[model samples]
Target: MILLQANQVARHFGGETLFQHINLEIKDKSRIALIGRNGAGKSTLLKMLAGEEEPDEGTITRTKNLSFGYLAQHTGLTSQKTVWEEVVSVFESVHAIESQMRELEKLISLESEKGNHADSNNYLEQYAALQQTFLDSNGYGIESEIKSVLHGFRFFESFYDQPVNTLSGGQKTRLALAKLLLEKPDLLILDEPTNHLDIDTLNWLEDYLQGYRGAILIVSHDRYFLDKIVTEVYELSRHQIYHYTGNYSRYLELKAAQQEQEWKAYDKQQAEIAKLEDFIARNLVRASTTKRAQSRRKKLEKMTRLDKPAGDEKSAKFLFQAERQSGRDVLAIEQAAIGYDDTVLSEPVTLHLRKQEAVALIGPNGIGKSTLLKSVTGQIPFLKGAAKLGQNVDIGYYDQEQANLTSRNTVLEELWQEHPTFPEKDIRTVLGAFLFSGEDVKKTIPLLSGGEKARVALAKLSMQKDNLLLLDEPTNHLDLDSKEVLEEALIDYDGTLLFVSHDRYFINRIATSVLELSENGSKLYHGDYDYYLEKKKEEQEVAEMTASKTEAEIPAASSAKRDFQQDKEHQRQKRSLEREIAALEEQLTNIDTHIAELQKQMEQPENLEDHEALTELNNQLTAQMEEQDAVMAEWEEKSLLYEDTY
Candidate 1:
């Protein structure tokens, strides 16, 4: 069934047409993605479709009483209720039915206590009917369902009691999305849903949305995320919507072919026009061919000329280069500890990056991945060992926050100020290469959006010509096209790289090695993100297999003459596993109770205004989750080994 439709939709800004002749249709269980470059008016059109704004022309229609949920980018939930209350508020109908069921229970009990079987039977039937309604509405497993979703968003059970108002902006955005999911509307409209999510959470969300019951219309720049969830793509470009019947990658393929065909048809018509014009010009003045010339002129006048084919939006153009090559062993870090003040987030992290190598730094949130990069750049003091640069290594840093930028300076002046000796034309040329032309160059840094600021930072980075670059979350605010351009620049860059990024697609294209950080240290996997995951899974399997190796300790143990030494070793291994299992069980029990305590606190209405308390609680919860993963892994390993011994 068609859930919504927009007919001849047109939108205008001021007096100019932003987009016109736009037609859209959304059906039940549709998975559509809206994609375009920045400033293509994708968000504006989404607002129109979502009924948050009305089109200046045309009309939008929806099914009667059609339900939908709209989640704008970076829009966080603001509520005084605890997380549990806020999410559970979606089930008010279920709650109302529960009240009815409870009242029925009271009447049934009253009659039963009086030994009046006839009256009790009527109340019992009402109770049974109400209970079935509750079950059908998913009232019974609410807590477990909440737990699964909360865990997927990294909320865990503890944060269930945390007031929705007290969460960090990112956390609140996640909660807003969580509440929307619980509502289970017939249509879901999400803009940039992947903004604040990590790889794990992104993975979880991809899985969740794949199984989502309602139709989804999303606007996001994460190509990987789009590829996984969306079945159709709508590209808003050149004041129009172009629909393609596939995912993002497939859309690219079809778009290229379509563009090629358009250009070809236009070129063919232009050639025919040129021939006709030449004939008319040459023969119009000649007496012998006057009739033929007039006929050609009439035909030319009647021809409906094809308009020139438009191309994609203007894209930034720049390349990263190195002035000089660094010596072998571009950078080396041994036993380095990085953190702020007294906190040692991670220690004994080692990396030996050779010349022209690209490495991706990855870790959980708050594990000090950024701190490690900063320590190398001398922005922070190392808590333990130092990062020694190899001979002639020059570092260029791209901070995600763009802090090093001259915010007060205009885009033109920001580049000009950096290289004052260069000519104005030369500076403008470079700025223009980054799509900051004309008056755009005069805009101050503070006025530029996140994507524009990112371009400015990248423009400066491209100019530095440094032999080594340390980038932190380099793809944070970039659109898909800009990210691809940057990826191309970095791929051809004649430098070494050690950058922190959560963009798995970017990492997959750029990284020669993956460095995973932990509290104790960092480990290097000699591959891309996917390969790193493969190696990590293999490590787990290997750990499991190590347990089954006790039989190999003594060949005769499987048969008759097992020596005392062999028996002793087996017993010792069994005893050690037993002790480890007992400790793990205790740790697991304690962590579970801690989580329950947080949930209890979340249940309290008083936590609604306690922002600082919630922040502290979140920090503790992160540690507990990390500990829980480790403990679970260890316990599973030991338990398997213990079973093999028997």
Candidate 2:
């Protein structure tokens, strides 16, 4: 069923059309994503659909009894109540139903005691009807439903008693989302819901939304989340809405095909019009052909002209080129502890980064990823141990907050002042490449939008010519197109890179390895994001198997000692075989680590120049890997045999 529909919807501001003649429908349980570049008025359109804003020229129609809820991009709950109280307030109707049921029970009992049979029957009938209504609405499970949503959002029991106003901005946003889910509106509209969510919470929310009963309209730049949750995409571009019937990746494919077709049709029509115009110009002067030319002119006047298809907006183009190569060991940290003041966030972390390697640092929020970066860059001193950069290494840092940008400085001044020796025209040329042409460069830092600030930072980084880069959430506030541009630039970079990001797609695109930081220590996976997930899953499965094995173990009684002893011998043999398998696995891991190190070394300029040394190292790595594989097969066979014997 269609819950709501928009007919010929158009929104205008300051006599300029943001979008016009837009028509869409929100159906029951539909999953739709509203996607566009930044400042394209996606939020404005969402507000119109949610009835918070009226369209200048259109009608928005909602079905009877249809309920809609909108979670704006920046929503904060202000309340004197505690977190739990604020969340449970969504079930006011359910509580009211309970109160009415109790009142009716008391009334029915009093009427019965007074021997008023007719009145007592009437009260009981009202009570029965109310009870049915309550049951149909799932009123009895209100608290459980609230708990389920809160838990999915990572709001544990400790957070329940906290005052709503005392919570962090991200916590408040999450609480607001949880309340919306509990409200169970017929149409739910969310703007940038993934902004403050960590990976685990993002995953859980995706699962929850998949099972949700109501329709969802979401606007988010998180490609990975959109790909997982949305089935249909509505792209708002150039003052128009275009629909695509798939996820974000599929939308790209179809949008490209569509643009190609549009351009082809447009070119064909323009050619035909040009040919007719030429013929009319040449023939119209002659008396004999004047009548025919007039007829053709009338035909031309009756023809419809196709508008030229617009191409994509301009995007930033830059590369990260190092002035000189660093040593093979670009960075080294030994027994490092990172945090503020006396608080140690992570246990001693030891890492060795090689030249030309791109590492993605990921963990839960407040888990010290950024703190560690600061310690390495000397913004904050390390709590313990040492961090050292290799010979000839130069550091370039990109802070997510753009703290280096002064509010008083103009865009041109920001880049020019960074390197005063460069000519003003040269700086302006670079700014133009970043799409800050004309008066755009004159805008001060404070007046610039978040995306504009990000571009300024990238322009500064590009001019630094640093060999080593340490970035903290560089993609924050960047539009999808800008993010892609940065990704391409980083992928083509010749320098060593270490970045902290929550964007899984970005990690998948640019990371040569993943360094997963935790409270315990960091684990390095020698592949992309997908490989990290696979390895994590395998580790979890092993842990579960070990736990199940321990839980299943039982002790034998005194009477069965003799039989137990006989079985114990078999167990002893099994334990010995397990020890051998463990040893083989450890050896295999060592070989794998060595192979990764060798590969990293092979990419160095010096090693590449010496072909003989590179070939020798490669051959050694190949032999060790072959031996490791053989040992792994033998271990697997022994493990299977041991399981069968047990």
Highest TM-score scorer: 1
Model 2 segments more than 4 A misplaced: 102-128, 273-303, 551-646
What value does the lDDT take at residue 537 in candidate 1? 91
Pairs of colliding residues, candidate 2:
none
Tens digits of per-residue lDDT, candidate 2, 96-130, equal 98899999999999999999999999999999999
Query: lDDT of all predictions, in order shown?
Result: 0.88, 0.87
| Candidate of highest lDDT | 1
Per-candidate TM vs. native? 0.82, 0.81
- How would you encode candidate 1's per-residue C-alpha lDDT over 459-505 as one tens digit per residue? 99888899999999998888889999999989999789999988888
Worst 10 residues of 1 by lDDT: 551-560
**Model 1 TM-score on a 0 to 1 scale:** 0.82
